[model samples]
Target: MNLRTNFVLGALLLTSGVWSQTGLVPKQFLSLPLGQIGPSGWLSDQLAVQTNGLAGHEHEFYHYVSQTDWVGGNSFYSTLEEAGSYWFNAMVPNGVLANSSVLNQKTSAFLDYVLSHQDSTGWLGPEVNTTKPRYLWGRYPFMFGAIQMVEAHPELTDQVVNALHKFVALANTMLHNGQGQEDWTRVRWPDFIMVLQWLYDFHPNGKEDLLLDTMKQLKFTGAPWEDVFSTELFPKGATDNMRNPTGFVLTWHGVNMAEGLKALPATYRFTHNQSGGLSRIIGILPLMSLFALDLDRASEGWDLLFQYHGRPSGIFAADEYLAGLEAVRGTELCLVVETIGSYLYQVIGDPKYLDRVERIAYNALPATLTGDFWSRQYLQQQNQIAAQNMNPHSRNPFPNDGPYSNVFGLEPNYPCCTVNHPQGWPKFITNSFLTTPDQKSLVQAYLGPFSTRTTLANNNQVSVSVDTLYPFSDTLTTTITAAQAFTYHVRIPSWVSGGTISINGGAAQALSPNNGLQAVSAKAGTTKFVLNLPAKITTGTFQSRPHGSIAVQRGPLHYAFDIPRNSTVLARNAQESRAVDLQFEATAAWQYAIDPSTLKFINSPPQSGALPSPIFDSNLPPLSIEVTACPINWNIAGSTFAASPPQNPACVGAQKTIKLTPYGSTKLRIGEFPVFKST
Candidate 1:
């Protein structure tokens, strides 16, 4: 019944196989090709900064607990701080500790602290000194830190190894004594699993009697798996969401649960023939209702995310009310990052998932980061300022709508996000490139730079390299090098225009129109992917406006450019209208140069100072211009900023400047463009 202890034991059981590879990975788990687009830690950097700020934070944990009775009285702050600090350090290149010496010293010091405080029961947790020292499970992370230190710095001393074994023995003891809890299910299961599996994988034939009982309780069978498709709430006292605003039922993403189910096959294998544990857990729910298992579930979630709950930047929120009520209040940065993380796991093979992944990565994900990638807003809305400042975690006020505003840090409204959010960025960067059991690889997402060696299904080792300037350039090229033959599937993005596939300097085959990947069959030589995407644009109608034409999609993003009083285009709650005629002015004007650096916003004037004004800082980036020749001239009446520019500005003597840019490029500009046709 002890969940934490059970998880430890189950991990030991799963790690029955110990294997190492300095070369190619076997053809089992798909391996992503080495590519730059998937390597950048743009979002990951933001999360790490926040994590370091909070964990050893002066008020959050370290400093506060250090001053309280909890540090030396009844709790194990010393070890928790050590474990957290070590894991946090393992992430960064130099980390908190400058070099191997510092890392080893810190690790050794932590081990010494833990060894000095170990209770006779072999259990180590929060209540290290109490009679019921076994009651706490929070200290389990220290054991995880031990394994991490070993992994990050392989030069573990004999003393370090001996110290680690003691912690493991203590963990084993806790399980034997039944000190683990039953209600604790892993929301961050993958993180713990990585360490647990590592221990068993490295020390095969180490312990069986110690892990058997714990594995049984740790399996998904006993964990509560709810119906994620429906809006069904968990029983009042049974779960966290019952408290309202805190639970996964309403607030947690269904996609995350779906992704965990999809990854069950590998974990099942890790457990060594002990199967059905995953099914037993999944069997509790309607299989058809599982979003990852059924397409309908995906459609429904997407319907809400795209059609109803979508924001201008492409992220969706799980907030109480539908988004667009107040874009800032609805979308949480954690939810945005986690949603993508889950979706990638569930549908990595599908092109649609890749499309959504790219959209969210380029749009929603970047919206939160400051221009320099330093500070981040927990939530962001269109037509709102996006700097790091305190804002209400709950609803907003007045015209913005929702709860109180200007709140900061990890508020009670939802603090789990504070911890859970960090996992997203790191995982996102790592998983972007996956290697199929066969060494052949594909580019699932694009960031910047990274590389890994992988094994293919045929057991051939291929060094797959991906190179591209994406989000900026339309073409992405992957070069595969191997001693043998291997087939690689390259995901052709849904947004790609005139995307052609050429392998090893041969005539390219035009893959199935949009969104279909072009598979490349080649040997050890060298294959190149050359894609020529001409400038293109698509138009959609504003459902609410009469004779209004709105631009729905351009390249990979949907854009809206709203200029002042004629602001029907990017106004509050603006949507696609059927009555409007949307025309793409495919002329020279449609290709204006844009300044990428000028994408920030000007602050809104304070209420007491003056009236609400629709103005932006002149210092912001200049809009990317496109000259679209329109048939009609609405500016004959002297309106300088017409919805659409006239064929000839001289007729109206209103030579107005038309500033148009990609919707994804601007966080400050009005997105919806007004539509004007005869009538």
Candidate 2:
């Protein structure tokens, strides 16, 4: 049979029962299993660099990763176990996507050890005994890591599911008995609930009651995110205390708030009863009702949170806490990765979530890590000038963070970010594409250079190869090969004004975006199309500095003044010459205000056929913009952090054209710039 006939037959066979096995609300799109999607082109090169950098080497030297409870070593603190879990969770996808045997072997060994060493009581991880005050927080990431592994390698599914079943039984009992309920686990229960939902959907084995009961226990004991977002519990602005009336610290935390954003949507899928009877009415009438987890309310709360606390880098300020919208305030690396993950969860609910994910991934994520990915900053400032340690006596801008908060190092300020940072890029690559609810279509949820091969609902295998220098170039070339006909959906970002698509070397046609997605139909054989998303320079004023200062964006990338810097090594690894800790001091003046009218975007084609090894390096960005700027008296706060740009500041020197590169490329950058007053 031809492709069209096979697709039609497959559609006839697809039933509601086949799609709705979990008895939950239907998602618009479903994530392709791990190993189905792989990175290519610049993205592939980037992951390779990451594998050869700190992420690959940390296991050999970093004590937290090297000597952790997960690997039969002794580490007392729960944070240590949690750190190890983060590394494992990130490496699973990185290894699978990059096809790196080294990473794959290390990840496999860790998984084997953890699965083989499960306690008799069904508890997973090192905290086995109840007398030690068990914390369920660390298990969250480990379970996710295991789930990814099972997705990549299906042979491990039976073992993983059986182990999860045992653990869920024990966890259900513990939660009922008021055990393993800590602050971190309480707010982060959404992650745990997600795992249960995944198990119920994919492999229930007639244990639906147990999964639902466990989910209920978790929701009851967990942070009331639905109530928090709907009521006054949601902070209107940056407040010192984000504790609700009951004294639960949920929204105050940067990472917790980011993770908690998905609680409502996730709960709605399982708990939301669409039958609409007296039970539904009763559930909705009560204040802060358990069944009132509306997706709309969740979206509104997300927007409101970013409105006040958000920064130009597409993340909210959280120097350990919810810092306000001032450009000087820094966002923690943990928050950045969690924010991206939270948005990815909501992409099925709203395609616009992909926009936020791309912005954070391309800008905030790379800017915080070094070009080699060997070191990273605990907190990344929007208008950062230097990465040196601040004087202890000086008034620190990040009151909740430490003096080394912004410095690039192995474990500056904290080790949480060090381990957690690996997840940002790897997850982004894996979650780039999604399948439609009916499985007749594949959606390019996030734009990037990646390829996917997966079986559709019709049981017909389809392969898509996407080649592009996106967020850097306007054109994307996609080649699809399928055994059956399928619809291909590409997300046309809101930033594109003149988008066009040409299929099979035909005439180019205007690309109309519907809810930020454009669809095209394909046959059984190979089909090729080129999508041109021409981006223009877009500028917007900062919320903290609305009048005289602004941030620049083109497509998904944020542009910043690339301040020249001089590096100083603070600490070096004993086994290698690489610096474990380093400081970047600005060698040239960064106090510049730009003339927006004179901004000119420039693209330099690579002289070679391939892109740079580290695409995020200072001198490696293929695109930049030249703008007329002049030196201004931008002051520094606490002798370290850059203060908010001066309102209507006068230029201090002669105006000169300066280059502004992608925010991710610059270590010392001025992202939010003051507008120069020509007078």
Q: Residue 188 of model 2: what lDDT? A: 92
Write model 1 residue lDDT over 1-679, tens digit each, in one string. Answer: 2344434534453454321111111223342321222242223333334334432232223321222333353332443533343333223222222223433454455455555666565544445565543432344445544544554455653444555455555654544555453323333333333334444445424553433333333333223222332233222111222343323332244234333332332233233322233434655433211112233343444433444345545555434333332323335555565556433333323455556666666565544433333223354444332122223452232222223111123321333333333334444555566555323454334333334355556566666555543444454566676667666655556556676666566786666642344556657766555554433454432112112323345455544442221111111111212112111111122211122222232223233432111111122222244433222233211111123222222222222345454454443333433333211
Q: Evaluate model 1: give its lDDT.
A: 0.39
- In order, candidate lDDTs are 0.39, 0.79
Any idea what lDDT model 2 has? Answer: 0.79
The regions of model 2 sitting more than 4 angstroms off are: 1-22, 67-80, 241-246, 273-286, 289-291, 342-348, 541-547, 677-679
Each model's TM-score? 0.57, 0.92
Q: Which ten residues in a row have the lowest lDDT in candidate 2?
A: 10-19
| Model 2 TM | 0.92
